[model samples]
Target: MNLRVEQRALAQSDQDDVVVLGPNPADTTFETTSTEGAYKILGVRPGLTISVFDMVIGADFAGRFATEPCVAIDFLFEAAGQGWLLDADGERLSSLPYRPGRIYIMAAPKGAVGFYDVPVGTRFKGMDIRVDTTLWQKLGAGDILSSLDEHHSLHIASGNGTWVGVLPVPPQLLAVARALFDSAMVENDDLAFEARALDIVHASINAMRSIQPAATIPPRDRRPLQRARDLMIAELSYPWALDGLAREIGLTQKRLQTGFKAMYGYSVYAFLQEQRLLEARRSIESGEVTVTQAAMNVGYGNPSHFSQLFLRRFGVQPSRLRPSETGKYQEAQAR
Candidate 1:
């Protein structure tokens, strides 16, 4: 899921709290200036690297962050057994491990972010990495880049920070033992260039593994709720008014409404709307239709209606719900 995060720092008088990014209530671009605080977010991810395997192996990271000049401090962090901390001249000062339940923070000097080229080969798997630590903390620290499984995570507290480099991994062992060809082998290798590459790959995999699984509540046995849901999903050929669906399912509209709420955790109408919006997103992402066409195909006679629903469901407008857009939406949902 792709995430479009917009943050506005609160005034100094008020304890600063970064506003969560969501559907805006008024006519305001995310770029609008707010004296309240600095704003930074991941606007999009266009798959800068081509192949899935390449993304997994090389672990190329692309993102942005904002900082407060005076308050921010420059620091570098690396993982030593899951904990990460500031790397002060090759020595670990803090232990910021991969805690599953809590978010850890790292900060960098204002306006400084380190950029590096990570060559992830095809052997790495993106879904295997798990870094549940909130990306917001990472953003606050400056841009973060590292591998998933291996503790070789890297952090730049700001633009002023220097890299401690990718975690230790072994590359030369590839030719020695087939068993040493895994991500662990790479991470455990000599603490050099080849080893660093393996660490990057490991970090990426760990990150992929970190995301929570999709919600899987038991399906409702309630007939009307099930029937209404199935109909809405199966046939999106026409406008789906709530009354018709309730009637078709052989239940009073009220029963249908309450049953759906009890079972799906959303009202029947809302569930149906989500269904149509999801379909429209799929259509737009596949390049099978233009934004306008996607709206119409999903039974939204007016494009504005489609955009609003899309924004509500995925936190972005339908106009931006194409392939790259969909990926960002999906990634954000994972967070």
Candidate 2:
């Protein structure tokens, strides 16, 4: 999860609440003129950082961001639109949308590049936690350190190496996030900040523990069905329309759909989304993207969605990821 974030300065106005997250070279920040958004990045402890944000899109948005290696826990109170994890070549790697009212935990050994375009009037409110707390065999989960069992998603290797887990926000954590977003706490106040921040990490670890890995299924029918699967993997962007795919595999459309569901555990359309996300995750972790020309990399393509209006609004164009100067390292090395 390459979190595209901002640093906030908020104020009340006559008509609407104004949020300004101007560009600053000191810490991580993402800025755009068209969107009305709020963001505040606060340092909770030496190895922990938390950001509170709320925004409403003014145009279709597409951009990329970079980060230092750390675990990302995102709690979205309100959200719209979806994001894509893109690889070094600007191709999408993953597209598992952790929906609104849920917390998304992404454990990355290194930083990544991501692309997403929110609609012209959609809204977003959330808190992002960057973690490198206590260590458990290089895993930087605080409080719950060694309590994680083997069933935890981190213990299992995923298709693209990184693990993304989605969990409903516990009430205790939700209260804290809402308060932070509402600006109920003073920026400089350090009272119980570490404890609150660690609370989030602890909750994330517990939620992650409950996520069991999917059981691997053997090939159901290895002849034409296997051939069909291979073809899909080879050209993920190619629209493997039901009629064409079925004819190529010598099976009826119904048989092909049924066979795909039985073999891959998803419909043909869903499988494409799965593969695109996997490929993107692998590529995103490979390096940093220049962000000179970020394009929409979803399964479907339309000219209007990725238009000049979006580019002018965001002023970002990340084309591909390259080797980052800040190389990967152990959990606590940077701090």
Candidate 3:
């Protein structure tokens, strides 16, 4: 077992609402349900998280999802939903209903994303693949990252100029994608799923290479910007000042802003908020602190506001992770 998994213990509640908080932030699956649907997110192998979801939620749900730097490949078997792909500034880069019976992917740079308005009684069947940025980049996927949405799905050959990023899955590749669903259902077959995932990535990248790239913004100093990110994560409780963070990491404020987004796919403070929320989720799941304590530990001063942010980021109230909350959670699930 991953030590981080043991330490964090994120999936404690045996609840329908709370998602299993594994090491992969990109395990942040497509659209999670409050009480009407269920998903199983598994880190089937190293640097890989697979989420298979079947959703028909009881109420209207809008999720604010974020992830650490990662790439997501989605196979939407069936969907009647809509959402946007956002940028570093949280601007909508694309807004369209999810195309059903297709495979789409995005590189979650800042990965601050939203998925919602899934109407009642509608079904959603999909598999989401979340891979480490380093792994995908090592597979020569870095150059293609910009074309992938910073936070949403990008479609290709849609006649709209920006929609030219997704690679259409033809018959053969769709067969391969469907095969993965079978392997996911089988017991103890991690390698099978891993191999299929790689094949899907290779196929998508090959198809995507010929397309024009999105506008590029180069990181001025990768090392310094990375250091600044580290400093923020290590001291999230400390109120961060962009200028002070830049000075400490030996970069100008402007360079830090631009370079941080260029490298990490989000602005500095946005990234900090992401890290803080992730830590708070982990802390909440550990059952060692109240949600308020967990929030305060991660630099959030107001518990009510923290709960709101927590629900958005995680798709569940933070209290759901506590062991004591399992009965209520299970009751909700039973409904």
Candidate 4:
């Protein structure tokens, strides 16, 4: 993959409470080697302005829910980078990987960001996009949509502002964004790529708005289609059989394949493969998981096959992306 950055391996002993900022007084690259009971914040840029970019990762020690005390919103641009939520509503929260290309704007008072504390070794990477208020309102209507409250130590009051920057993306979406970005990086077509990426971004936002009522589309009307889709999404490992899923869903294999393709823009197998590859990508990005282990976790019994799939999905070999093995020129520089 064309990952622009790589972070140092996060230590297990790292705390889960406080966040670290800046390698030096003026440096924006924040680093923390421990997380025994605190949180950490890494900034790629030094000065605070209305606009900026960032790459961030977070890990929780107590559990997944331990991150609830933190509040930060990530913005993933179409350009393959994401921005971290730094100071929203006067408080700072650790950054984590969010869905790529999806617009998310959150504002909270202090303690709103506490939910971001993830387990040790968890890492998230993306570009940050920020804008001033004038530009934000132009994108869409601003409104107060949601609010969250929890432990006395953490509290958040949020409102949906005009999406200030780009949004977050899961690895599945990142694969698409990476492909688009690589093509742009190749032809030196920044303008074209940005436009296309923005179009995709708009489509995704519209899709987010297009939440159809499940009641309107009953299980009976789309039984076979939903069944295949559900099975493919639910089971990514251990060799999925078309006939088996079809039988379970009460449809012939041909019907299952055809219906799934017609409804979801992808064959069932292709969707499942993409999903598995996305999971593997996220696991490797976390740095705690090795390439071989990530491959197995995503259902590739053979490392070679996994590598091939990974390359096809992300345009990079799995070995090259893992944080454990370091030999490449760029990797050495990151350290």
TM-score of each: 0.33, 0.50, 0.48, 0.41
Ranking by lDDT: 3, 2, 4, 1
lDDT of each: 0.37, 0.51, 0.59, 0.42
In candidate 1, what are the lDDT values of residues 27-108, reduced to their tens digit? 2432332212111211111100001011122232212222222111111111111322323333434333221111122233
Which candidate model has the greater lDDT, 1 or 4?
Answer: 4
Candidate 1 stretches with Cα past 4 Å from truth are: 1-221, 323-335
- Candidate 2, run of 10 with poorest lDDT: 12-21
For candidate 2, lDDT tens digit of each residue in 1-335?
A: 12334332222112232221112223333343466756566655444566776667665344655445556778876566677666777677666553455567666555555666666767676777776533323444343433333233233112233455555444456656655555423454344555566666776666665543323322333356656765775566676788999899888888778766764456887766555443332233233221222222433354344333333432321122223456432222323
Measured by TM-score, the strongest candidate is 2
Per-residue lDDT of 137-242 in model 4, one digit per residue for the tens? 3545122112121110111122222112122234545555544544433344434544544544444444433322233323343555655654654556758878
Report the number of clashing residue pairs per model: 49, 17, 1, 51
Go through the candidates in order and give the C-alpha RMSD of each one to the true structure.
22.3, 17.3, 18.7, 12.9
Query: Candidate 2 at 158: error in angstroms?
Result: 6.7
Q: Mind giving the per-residue lDDT tens digits that candidate 3 earns over 70-150?
A: 666788766766766555566555554564545666555543454345665666767877777667777887787555432
Model 3 residue 52 lDDT?
69
